[model samples]
Target: MSRPLVIDEAEVEITAIRAQGAGGQNVNKVASAIHLRFNIAASSLPDDVKARLLASRDSRITQGGVLVLKAQRHRTQELNRLDALARLHELVQGVAQPPRARKATRPTRGSQLRRLAGKSRRAVVKAGRGRPDLS
Candidate 1:
């Protein structure tokens, strides 16, 4: 059986705010934008995953170790809420999958020879660019 996805509900927080940009009269009145906040430090995720999530260069993650995602693309509150939650799930899942470690490698002898040959060819072409000695 496939394992269930584990997420700590306590680590996430959500709030509604007025979405900016064009929306007619309704935009000024209603707070439809969903703000989802996830605290990396307080999360129940593994240390490695937490480190990756916190170290990520995403603009959503603030300096205070909180990830803030805004979902205002959807018109309704329910859809916006779902979008925010899905984004959170995706972000967590991304960190959950660890990257494979890279093994050190060296260039092959043939590759080295090819590179040297290419450099020699380029040098000959450049050498030809010089004016012929008139003397």
Candidate 2:
């Protein structure tokens, strides 16, 4: 298997922001959450990888091809920062490998027969519900 893409530290911009939700007194004062921003267009990744990353349906990737990640699971700023970087690494790695091409195939003969049989049975049931024809 090919190795995953390694993002350069300089390409990522991390900011420590105040975390939301409950943490008692520490939550109100400490800036433990890390917000990571990486511009795919400006990064050193391969052209194909960049295209794949941008084309992904992930909400984290913005319209301008910038990835935004928030890490606040940890209480400490250092831990949050590391978490953000790890997440970013995974995101890049996700698009590193090309997707497998889907092979088109027709339905099996047995399945087709089963479908036709079901349709005919339904038609018979519907026909039974109709009014009796006068001679």
Candidate 3:
């Protein structure tokens, strides 16, 4: 049996920064943006999950195997913090479930026949593009 996945809140580091872009005068004064950082190498997650997370091609994962997420959609700092945590949960949950193995398949006999017939028709059309037959 595999071990259950669990992420401790203490392992996550959260910081509040200023949000960028237009937002009247309040945007520059308040630190509403949330910056969440989770280190995969130092987390309690299973080894497999850690491996998969580091191997992921997501732009959020840094070169040092740390997951960095920035949340600024909400105007309040508390909401942005929650949003960042939610996103982190989603990423961890995704890695917890193993991917289904793919089953190789071949085209049915009827499909193969149809494909061959289409190829033959295309060849005939291309052959017709050549000079017309002379008597």
Number of the top-ranking candidate, with lDDT as the measure: 2
lDDT of 2 by residue, 41-115 (tens): 999999999999999899998888899999999999999999999989988888899999999999999999999
> Which candidate number would show the highest TM-score if scored against the true structure?
2
- What TM-score would every model get versus the actual structure? 0.90, 0.91, 0.90
Candidate 2, which segments miss by more than 4 Å at Cα? 129-135
Which residue pairs in candidate 3 have backbone atoms (N, alpha carbon, C) closer than 3 angstroms, thus clashing? none
Number of clashes recorded per candidate:
0, 0, 0
lDDT of each: 0.87, 0.94, 0.92
Off by over 4 Å in 1: 1-5
Per-residue alpha-carbon lDDT of candidate 1 for residues 22-85, written as tens digits (9 for 90 to 100): 9988888888899998898888878988899998899989999999999999787889989999
Candidate 2 lDDT score relative to the true structure: 0.94
C-alpha positional error of residue 86 in candidate 3 after TM-score superposition, expressed in Å: 0.1
lDDT, model 1, position 71: 96
Q: Is candidate 1 or candidate 3 better by lDDT?
A: 3
Candidate 1 local accuracy as lDDT?
0.87
lDDT of 2 at 42: 99
